[model samples]
Target: MGIPQVSETVERLWNGWELRMVMLLSLYLQIFLILFGRRRKYTAGFWIGKLVWLAYLSADWVATFSLGILAQKIGDSNRGSIPAFWAPVLLVHLGGPDTITAYSMEDNELWLRHQLVLVSQVVVAFYAFTRSWWGKDPLLFVAIPIFVAGIIKYGERNWVLRSASSEQYRNSVYSEMNELDSKFDKFSNSEFFEMTDERLVREVDLNGIITEATFLHEADLFFQMYRVLYADLVLGDSIHLATHIILRKKSAMQAFELIEVEMGFMYDVLYTKLAKVRKSRVIFRASIFLCFVSALLAFSLGISKNNHAYSTAEITISYLLLYGAIVIEIYSVVLLLFSDWAMLWLTGKRKPLFDSVYRTICSSGFLSFLQHDKRWESTMAQHNLISFQRSKAKLTSISLKKLLGKSNIQSSKVVGADLKKFIFQHLLDKRTRYNLRMRSHDPGSNDLHEILSERGDEVFGREESLENFVWSVKFPDFNESLLAWHIATDICYHDDVRINGGNAKIIHQNTETSIELSNYMVYLLVDYPFLLPRGIGKERYSQTCSAVDDHAELLDRIISVQPFSWYESAITFDIEKSTRKVSALWAGVKLAKSLQALGTQDGWGNERKWKIISEVWVEMLTYAASHCGWKEHAQTLTRGGELLSHVCLLMAHLGLSEQCLTTSRLD
Candidate 1:
């Protein structure tokens, strides 16, 4: 008898609290998304991303579930008026945060499905509102403005999602290019801006003064011209011709800054509600915020007169939902004002006052979070080959770790200043010059890609001193080649450490650049293999790591004490996993010997040898950058992006793309 009574009482409370619980959960989800969704653009971590991902997926379900519960309670006279008023509050949560419209690029492709669900949900929302207290209740009348705001919010999400889809995005790009062609009837009509030879980019009409606003406009221009690259489309050779003519004149610093701005635009296009820059966005912002304010005012007044009739819990929840929503909506509108989209549109208008104030705030750096992110953390994750082995060499298979995407890495470093300049200048001079000559003369995408994707071998052919080391690139699969080079680079780097007479001594700049690029490549292979050319990289990597693990003590001794040759006792070349284990270590040792021999062969110093090694690594990096598919590049933008994606976009602008160097998207 006691158990039965307890069960009955528990069921009663659950039935009463189910709708309220779901309502609060849906609001909490909206709060979570508004606060944290933007972090995925700039933060790099597993747990933060997972939390936001969970919240993004759950926000919609809870809102829809709340509506279903309300639709079921339409005739319960005491609760009906409260549920009816709360129904539209659920719709505002369904609108989601302005910071996130789609979680991934693939989510944008499913806009039609979202639209169908939107229609069904709107039908249910209306049914629940109209069935209860229609003409009799003042609460139902106050819900009218909230209902309108909810529809606009939900519909705006679907619109942005649709605009970001591939077919819609590509069509818009083509239409804008046609408009550009119409505007440019003659070269003489175009006005020169940024007259400095090192930073010049073509603009239509402006005084020669370059403000912070000018960078936003410049980013808008570059994004318009090159945005098609993100979607894997081809551009006409003329767009290629026009871009390279300007890019070639830029210094490495100016060049990277320009690319950073363009990438910021790409991030907005993929992740946020700003799918395209337009004046219509301003109007939408005004409409949504005004609707929210009007609803809050009407609801507060209506509820006060009927305050005695509703339950205390019902009144409290209604106030929380209203006040919380208006606060969030106000912040969203302020974010829109400070967004790159708003700044871009505002900058384009030459109307005097807005442009000056906008530029002043941009340069002032008052709200640093709102500033267009100039660099994303400026750090690269570091996962060295031997270090990975030393850390993760238990008996379990690596296949599971790969499947779950658990990285063996826990270390990262700021991308060194000189390393960035070194890579920028190398691609600026070598890859661009070579790719342009080939593509302009012959335009076969596949054949051109195959030829240009020579990872390190081409560098050998170009440099006379490194001809003897060409076989290392030629003798293995690309993955094997990476392992071989990584092994050799590590050995040579340690040898330099010893040669400096102390491990703490600052080495040559070229040696530091070589090791940084080398370790970064291994990080990509281990953690983000899809960004690399299709390869046996992970398999080869695991085997090489095992090799280092087996002989860690001996290897350490060789580095700190004796010459490498004294460790011959440790070698047993089991040929089955030739690219891994002992055989792989031998390959590295042999290559290291060859590099050292080359350093001593003539009048060349350590600087000459390190320069060759660093140049080869840069070539390998660019080769991987170009050959990675554009879709992979687009997907990485959500995870704070990758250095390889940054390089790939810059490569396209300089005519070194794996594609035919033809794409244009301007809106």
Candidate 2:
């Protein structure tokens, strides 16, 4: 059969309209990417994440498909007469979006595939350029340098991907350890000054002037502590001292700012080229700018000379390409300048002009918006399984109203508790006591749970039986313990008013923390099973669900008498006696009653009672956070992140995880 041919009308349309449409489409995709690329970090909504994911994948595909079409056009005699200038423009588009390099950690590991794509695309772009070359056209001169810049930018994305791969990142950390070890050896024998009990009672004096210098100093100190994250190193006593010094010196807001900057650096290292190009950022920036300028100048000269036969549409498209490249470059430069990386670099220089500029930018509302905490991490999405189940049970009008989207909601409710500050304060207090006790006597091979329990005992005046009951250090199954505690917390929370009617303020605060932490732990249990301890969270969840279902008739009666009173009635039915099997809810109710009875029998004050409960909750939270794998934590970053993951990292940095033991062994 003879090869098929298109009609002249179709050919003309393809040449004149379709090609420009694709180019315009590619440009629009780039614009979308620039605007929405960082939205995933700030949002945990299903649609927003899906949209960003779509844009992320589609941007590369559209650019590549358009380049293929351009290549096909280069071979057609009729379309061959059309300006091939768009070929290099497509190359620039194919360099991919700047706002994201890798969507997730797994993407970083696929750098080899991207490298192959880079080679193939460069060859295809070059083929299109050469086939359409008509001997020294001024427009071709403009395209050449812009193409080089595009290649460099694209190559940079892949280089960053390789550098950030876990293996490569660990290697980079290991590379620095020889110097670290030498310094460590030199300091190992130096006797450290121990603070006396009297000196410890007096808070560390922090009267230094709070300025950019002070903030930078604290950031540098924290960054040193954070570097252990990359190296898989234990946060030793040096890290503990650094954290204490910084926390003592800085206010909570200032301390959180340093943390934000540290997280920003981490985000860049994992998902951007910040670490890969830090040293040569200025040089790379200048090179890209100069290339764009050269392209702009060459294109302008070509327009002035009118050396080639080009349609007005083609000429306009060329102009858009040149201007778009320059404008995007300028935008990227602005982002780089206002970034935490730039701030860190400027702080290191200690120049007055740089400091003034930094201060001015920091004071601006726009810069604040750019560097806002939300940009780095979203407020964690709360997902309590029991709450979720209650909502699903359709038991209450309020939950039904929320389900039907009729709660007069105007914005996403800040439903989750701000536990970061609380966790930090608790760790700080615990570490102080831990250091004191460690100095006084040997801790031996005691794990994190033991240490926390020992320190907790000291704080609460040694309630041995109570401590053992609340947090059994030798408990073999974490999942079961979590279920028991979670249920107990929920029961106690609902029964708070009945238990402590007079002290509203203390009861309310403790109840809030207990409920929030309880829900968060259950969220991990049901939604993120891998992050929980070694048992099957799903199987346990299924068993609980089956038990709840089996008691449907009884639950209906309870709900009829008092809706949302499942916990109240659940306490009466002993799980051990029930035919359906031991229910988590029943176990929880027993625990709650026992705890309340203990409080009454011991004549414990409201403060002491709540303190004990909160301490136990913190211990459970720490246990889960410390036990969850780092890979599991990293996996959550692309999904607007999770509080569990943040807590995990925080626990590791605080030297409260068994991973720290592994790291110590490495040393």
Candidate 3:
């Protein structure tokens, strides 16, 4: 028998090999999209972000290209070809990944463009199906339902993008408030005011002990408060209540977890179909499930009926496409089940069945892996320009290590678990004290700065005169103060080690936190200067660098003479005079000396002295964070977010932000 071959027309119009390659490429892109879309939320390293960025851009392009190829093949071929059978699968791919609908906030604004693409692609897909199937191709039964499901999925994505856009979010919030107001006016003014105030007061029990359950309930109740963040609305009594009911009561770890869940909800509201899915969750899930099942059944029936008509390669590709769609749908279902949305649902339920399921899931190890709260597991990254300048050789070595894909060289410098707990506890204590003071006085009686200063004095057991010396008069310029305090902390930290001598190990824990935070703040100063208070000139930074460089020779000599000696050992070479003549380092050295002297004079233990310094730095950090513009904090969400931004949001919620003062004025 003569060798069987494809006809000349078929070979010229559409090659089987080319169609297969495109189909395989589309599948590979889908796999990449699904795997890496959510990785950014957990891993904020450079390489991971780059890979996710690449995958994000390519997923849509590859899917669109495959759809184009399928359309072309169907139009060109004399008879219906296998590639035509795959057009609906392309539609499914075009729906995009569930993990990310909009890559950034701006992407949400392009929903109309996505909608246009949706319409055009659906037309092209339908045209391809008509050209190939006419009335004969049984796979059309499968294609029709899958096509519908794909359109629905794509529409859901567009809807989410639109809803998440800033304008839309603000409008939604305004509409909700207006509706509430309209309902209120239906009652007498006195009655309405009494009922509303009662509702607000009854929502949270201020005197009651706060547990995880209570915190969760408060989070749900304060949805309106959080929603205002997106709309840039001024918070009122709701935020003050939140502080008393939630923020002040929880331990640091619990507070952080609450914030994590809150951020997770924000992420969902801004980036995914979560808001839409949440409205008709059960119905939506059932509808999608039915579509998948119907598509599978239709595909199975079509294949069984026409098994002999299609080539083995074509049949295998068909099966792969069907199964791939099924797998993606299943994965999305799992994500929905494990998300904070599920937790929210569980929190709202009164049913025994849901409560038991929630308890079981919360206790399971699997929940840890599924939880999408952490942006990065490490506390925060550290990058100090001054430290880098001090050690060029070490910088070169770190660069090499990074190039070789080694872990962070400063990973050891990450805040230890014990230190984190201490910082949290100290901050919580300060907040509690501040809250008490506020309650004891009249509302709006003291400004934020006055309150902070009073709290600082109380915490350090210092009178106003001593507080003025350490913080007020000596550190008038924010940047200069930061530089001086940072250097002072470094000096004291090294000096404390030498002073402890035989007991260095015992005192190391106390000094380590001070050193870490000092460096972290300086790192922020250099890398993210915009976050700090303004009005400090660049000359101040230059002067400090000059002072450090001027003392380099003495520093080297001190290091050589006493390899393990304290940094203060170099001060004997008129270092104090040079620092004073050159820049603010003089103030730093004096401050360090004063702190040490006070600790000795007051018989404050090594732990007690370091605790005071740590608390002071934490206060400074929180002040700076709270002072930064909300728009600046919002901008960080696209770059994998930051702890500072989270802190700012927390501060705003607790009615501690200066931004809140301005916002309140607007009201």
Query: Highest TM-score among the candidates is held by which one?
Result: 1
**Per-residue lDDT tens digits of candidate 1, residues 276-326?**
555677677778678767876776787677776567787788778888888
lDDT tens per residue, model 2, 325-395: 78877877777777766776666566677778878888899998776654445353345544455545664
Question: What does the lDDT read for residue 380 in candidate 1?
Answer: 73
> On residues 79-114, what C-alpha lDDT tens digit does candidate 3 reach at each position?
344635588778878777678787777888898898
**lDDT against the true structure, each candidate:** 0.71, 0.61, 0.63
Q: What C-alpha RMSD separates each model from the true structure?
A: 4.5, 6.1, 6.3
TM-score of each: 0.88, 0.82, 0.79
Candidate 3 residue 480 Cα shift, in angstroms, is 4.1
Q: Could you tell me which residue pairs clash in candidate 1?
A: 224-665, 224-666, 234-662, 235-662, 235-663
What's the lDDT for residue 568 in model 2?
Answer: 55
Residue 594 local lDDT, model 1: 84
Candidate 2, after superposition: displacement of residue 561 in Å?
A: 7.9
> What are the runs in model 3 whose C-alpha is more than 4 Å off?
1-19, 42-46, 78-80, 133-138, 175-214, 275-279, 363-369, 372-378, 394-409, 412-446, 449-461, 464-480, 500-508, 526-608, 631-641, 658-667
The true-versus-predicted C-alpha distance at residue 128 of model 2, in Å, is 0.9
Q: Is 1 or 3 the stronger prediction by TM-score?
A: 1
Provide the clash count, candidate 3: 0
Error of 1 at 11 (Å): 3.4
Best by lDDT: 1
- lDDT over C-alpha atoms for residue 336 of model 2: 78
